[model samples]
Target: MAFDEGDAPGRVVNGLSVDVEDWFQVGAFEGVIERDSWGGLDDRVERNVHAILNLFDEAQASATFFTLGWVAKRHAGLLREIAARGHEVASHGWDHERVFRMDRKSFAADIERTRKTIEDCCGERVIGYRAPSFSIDQRTPWAFMELAEQGYLYSSSVAPVAHDHYGWADAPRFAFNPLPWSDLVELPVTTAQFRGKRLAAGGGGFFRVLPYAFSRWAIRQVNRDEGRPAIFYFHPWEIDPGQPRVAGAPLRSRLRHYTNLEKMAGKLRQLVREFAWGRIDVIAHREALRLEAEKATLHRASA
Candidate 1:
């Protein structure tokens, strides 16, 4: 399908988020690092997250932290710190389990566990969720119902780009309701229309691998040209270039994970400074308001 053309004006606020997981917990390292041995690894998540908090504070930007159930269980204080420091805390599911790898029951339990753990730590409801690897595509159509049922107001788990590991190539690039009967919003991570092709313009490895100038241009396209809020996310470990490396991992995985580590913080600072950033909850609330206004307008048109 063709990309959604921009209709609104240029001044749009984008959403910033962090997938709060340790360096060892990433899917790229799952092959080399077993879950049982995770505890023994050097954990830089807390220190890295604190550094991120400091960065955001310096930039005067707000963001959402989609934390893991396991991470929250271990770092309850850090979870609370994220909330206390003026950012929203949401769910990134138990561990880094992908949605397509589980049944409905398991997925539901995972979401419940993650959300409850985050709320318990922060003492605030976790109404937003992002599937571990943006795995809520064609295979998991029922995922939205589960999220809505579990009291989640929205999800940012789908990136509408073509990819080998994760991407719903045909899904809408912006936020939309996947279910007709529910109000749950699927807020996709940002992607850019590069010469009629959808490409990863959001955060993560793509943001790292690509030139900062291109990333900057794409985000400006989404904000000023598309007139929609772009959702960008990265992990706490991305900034921690000094984290221990996983030996004997796939060359691609190692490259994807480790590349641009030293450059991540500088690029992030520039990106944050260049655009307006806010929490995912704020974006969801604005989406709700926009939908309501559209409904009202349609009602008036019919009357």
Candidate 2:
């Protein structure tokens, strides 16, 4: 159902999120770089994160940072900095392990560890999660059950697009409760329908590869036409044009990862300026209240 602007009477507030992981730790490079070797790599995350923080500050916007537990363990101060700036801290898993790559037991342990690490570092409850590379699809539907059980209020792990590596093509394009009995909300990554096709406008490689105007138009369409807040996400590495390039990754991986790195930060600034932004928790609460009100109305009508 299309939400009408008359219902809200203002610009829709979109969600801004960042996946905190180094360039080499990206899923495309997992085949080449072992987790054990990550420590030996140059620590560029601090500088890159600082850049993003500065950008957000300039925009006077708040965002949710879905950070890696492994990064928090090593750079607790960084997570604290994010919280001090008033942005929400959430989990991006203990490491960069994809949900499908792990079994139930392992996935539980991974999220639990990450939650603890983030909470311990920032002293704030980590109530949201976005699986690495949008990996929580039908094959890993149990991931949602685990997320709710583990205290996550919502997840932004499903991308409703067709891709070689990951996507759930038929998933709902807006925020939704995946199960009737579960409290967990599944906020799929934002996509905009264009020329009879649903396109990825929620950032990552799409934000980089596509012209910034395309993303801008897509997000505008979602906000104005659909009247729902769009969830836009990007990686810290996307803004770091000087980050070390991975060697020997497949041709496709290289193109997806390295394209338009230098232009990302500028495009992000434009995006932040163009739209209202909020944390995932804010959207979840609003959606929950709307659902509750709808249920109450239905009950009164039935009575």
- Which prediction has the highest lDDT against the true structure? 1
For model 1, the superposed segments whose C-alpha errors exceed 4 Å read 1-10, 295-303
User: lDDT of each model, Cα atoms only?
Assistant: 0.88, 0.87
What is the C-alpha lDDT profile of model 2 across 1-303, one tens digit per residue?
122132224768888899999887898888888999999998788888899999989988788899999999999999999999988999999878889999999999999999999999999999999999999988987899899888888899999999888999989898888877787888899999977888888988988899888988988898889888889889888998898878888888889899899898888898888788877777767776766687789899999
TM-score of 2: 0.94
Give lDDT: candidate 2, residue 199: 86
Q: Once all C-alphas are superposed, what RMSD does model 1 give against the true structure?
A: 4.7
Model 1 scores a C-alpha lDDT of 0.88
Clashing pairs in 2: none
